[model samples]
Each structure stands twice: as structure tokens, then as C-alpha cells.
Target: MQDMIFDNNQVLAVGSEPFLSRFDLNGKILSRMPCAPQSAFSVSLHPSGVTAIGGYGGLVDVISQVRSHYCTFRCSRT
Candidate 1:
């Protein structure tokens, strides 16, 4: 079994075989994803401008980070 989502809170469910169905806003099965294949276990959305995401494969995905451009001076013997 797999979980599917149509609108913000609405959800459409199906088995592993894969099929087609439609529904309305009241927890009804509307359309399907682009491929209409397997369903994702979980999904999330992140805002733009400096963000991070982690995966099961020990991978840390990042968008941006703070940077410094200051210079340092060094003294030498005469």
C-alpha cells in the first residue's frame, strides 16, 4: 500500500499494482502524479534562500551559506 496526496490536505490512495482514479476536494482521488507510478512515502517543501535537506544515504543537500571576504596581514623580520 502507498499514500497519495492531491490538494493541500486531500489524499488519494492506491495499491502496488497501480491504477487510475479521480476525486473531488472532500478527500476524493483527483488526478495522479506525472508518471502515475509508485507513490512517495513522504514529501516536504522548503523555502528559498539558504536551505538544507537530508536524505537516507547520508547526503546533506544545501542551497546557500554565509561567506566572509576579509583579508589578514602578516609581519616579517627586518
Candidate 2:
């Protein structure tokens, strides 16, 4: 797994798969939702129930509370 964050007693993880997975405290996976392809290296949860994932090639994906994708974008090197 590349990154993980705790949310409401659950663990949200991102990794090499194109998925964002949720697990319990014991490490049993609860759910997996598609995110960025290939890899995701960072994850953060927002107070508004949104999730932001940073992935390969500077890709960023935003997901909503209901497990739906909000948007995708890319960061340019400055």
C-alpha cells in the first residue's frame, strides 16, 4: 500500500491498483473502489466527505462520500 488514512474507525488505503480500498482495524478489507490507474501514492480525507488521491504522472482524483468519482486532474511541473 502506498498511503493510508483513518476515517470513522476504518482505514482507507491506496496503492498500485486502480482502487481505493477500505479496511477494518484488524486489516480485513471492507470495500474497494476504483480510483487512479496504475498507482496512487497519496491519500487525504476532507471534512466535507471528499477523498483526494495522488497518483502516477502527477494525477489527482477526487471521490465523493458515496463512492462516486468527482473529478480527475493532473499537476504540471513548475
Candidate 3:
């Protein structure tokens, strides 16, 4: 799951699957992505309307407020 700060009201949760999941303004799930398996982990949201998602083996994906995307260095410990 990915945590997103939308419209400054509450947090929005989007699934890690390739498809998109829908949620109401009240943070209720109106719909969900079709059952697709994807490797995803914890999610953190910033006040700047950015989202950070950690994936398996410690890969981090970042989504910017401008709708751009980036990936950060991965760190892991066994």
C-alpha cells in the first residue's frame, strides 16, 4: 500500500498492484484493483504531497507532487 496526502484533508491509500484503486473523500474504499500480485512494502507520505513506497529487498519508489516519478538507492540488511 502507498500513503498519499490528498487535498489536505486526510490520507489516501493506494494499493501496490499495477492497477489503480479508488477511495472516497472520506478515506473509504470505493473500489480496489483487480487481484494482481506485486511486491510492495511500507509506505510513507510527506506533507509536500509526495509518497514514498518501499519494496521488497529494500527498493524505494518515490512519487512527486508534480506527478513525476523517481527511484532512490536501496538499502537492505539480512
**TM-score per candidate, chains pooled:** 0.26, 0.92, 0.53
Clashing pairs in 2: none
**Tens digit of lDDT per residue, candidate 3, span 1-78?**
654434454444545664224466766775443222254545566888676666555666676665456545477786
Candidate 1 vs candidate 2, lDDT winner: 2
Predicted model with the maximum lDDT: 2
Overall local distance difference test of candidate 1:
0.34
Using lDDT, rank the candidates from best to worst.
2, 3, 1
Superior by TM-score: candidate 2 or candidate 3: 2
Question: Which stretch of 10 consecutive residues in model 2 shows the poorest summed lDDT?
Answer: 33-42
In angstroms, the error of model 3 at 53 is 0.4
Residue 17, model 2: lDDT of 92
Q: Give the poorly placed runs of model 3, Cα more than 4 Å off.
A: 1-11, 14-22, 26-37
What tens-digit string does per-residue lDDT give for candidate 2 at 1-78? 999999999999999898999999999999999886569999999999999999998899999999899999988987
Cα TM-score of candidate 1: 0.26
